[model samples]
Target: MPRRWLMAALLALVPAGAGATPVNAYPDIARAYWVEIDGRPAWAGNADQAMPVASLAKLMAALVLDEEADLAGTVTVSRAASAATGTRLGVRAGETYLASDLFSAMLVRSANDVCRALADWHGGGDDDTFVARMNARAAELGMVSTRFANACGHDAPGQGSSARDLALLARAVMARPRIMEDARRESFAFASLDGRRFSVRSTNALLGQFPGAIGLKTGFTPGAGRCLVALAERDGHEVLAILLHAPDRWWDTVGLLELAFDQARRNAPPE
Candidate 1:
């Protein structure tokens, strides 16, 4: 009798065999995925289908700059680069910066102007050439679901990427030793071409809010509401989380991360 009751209680705790949380429970998100450091797919829903990434696309822009430009090289900011819309680094025409500085700005601050400047300064020869190279790099990286029409991740009607493609790209960026360091920075400063100092703060609200929340990026537009690709580290394990088309991106992202960490802990071997 006691043994039968124990079995029932244990079964009750099993939670229907660990399926994903209900969609209505998280109504704001269109799709998401949480990936372990070992490249294991832990949780996913609507991960393979392509969707608007908004400013999260800037992650690719930063990676492309990291690969193609010498971080120490100087770039003279063009009028076109400085005049870009949305969030900016407040750079002016004729301003110049070390390529790495712009890369930092692009990743840490999601600076639209810095992205354009970096693309123009080192993307083959011109803006068009640089955008082409970005797309080519995406293909080479097996981001078949991704298409880059601009360096700053502007709201182009057709430009988008799947959660799988983003996972691949995030893996590629995280693989580089320097990128982790760059993304983890909370703030950065640099001098423009005119020698004026510029300092930028990160847009990822969870950086210091949640435990082990590293840096990624945050984005939105009317067409794409509240997007994020965030990384967190706990107990020597790293997990990447991506959320798209979310309305309450801040709390939703935090909730997903907490759930992922909880799941990881439950699955971990006893210490």
Candidate 2:
């Protein structure tokens, strides 16, 4: 069966009104949002509306790289990668680093430079090929509302994703232990083959402040505003929240996570 049809069929199995919340439950929190508790939908608003997601697109890039590239391999920074805009590790063209280090930098720091280098390496010096792979992977993972225009999550025409689609993508990312390990990191440090060192801290503010927060990813752009995919586990219950174009993502995410956990507890079967 075609991937889209399979995805549609799977989505049909979710019960209507399963923990549905009013679209305006949290007014002005974000342009689009979705929350899930223990793998079931909990609340949503404009969840299917596609919008620019900025660095959150890195999650999908990480996924595609993990599936196809060898982390242990080395990648030399290309001129295009070294010239990438946005958050970067300042790697110079021709510098070589382990693919794993680049992967960590991409997730932990949202470093566009390393992300581009990884993509370029995976595409045999052509990041566009890697982006095509990313789009294909998005389709295979049932991210029907998601598309990749670049490996580093730059804002571009036709590059967008919905909160619902991001939730699906996040689930796929969480299933990969290596990727999650990187996501959970608060900071990463590494050196290139030339012995030039670099360090980067995670952009996810909730990592140290929010109890039980295990990361997911964060994003921002002039066009996308602020975006986040937050995952937290407490008392054997897990809550996953996605926010797109949020003005106050940190505060909004914390409230949503707490609400989801509370609902899970209230709905839990008695001991």
Question: What lDDT would each prediction earn against the true structure?
Answer: 0.73, 0.87
lDDT of 2 by residue, 32-117 (tens): 98878888786678988989999999999999989888999999999999999999889999999999999999999999999999
lDDT of 1 by residue, 15-41 (tens): 212343322223234555434432455
lDDT of 2: 0.87
| Counted clashes in each candidate structure | 1, 0
* Model 1 pairs whose backbones collide: 96-193
Best by lDDT: 2
Q: Report how far residue 205 has shifted in candidate 1, in Å.
A: 0.5
Question: TM-score: which candidate is best?
Answer: 2
The local lDDT score (0 to 100) that residue 174 gets in candidate 2 is 94
Q: Which stretches of candidate 2 lie over 4 Å from their true place?
A: 1-24
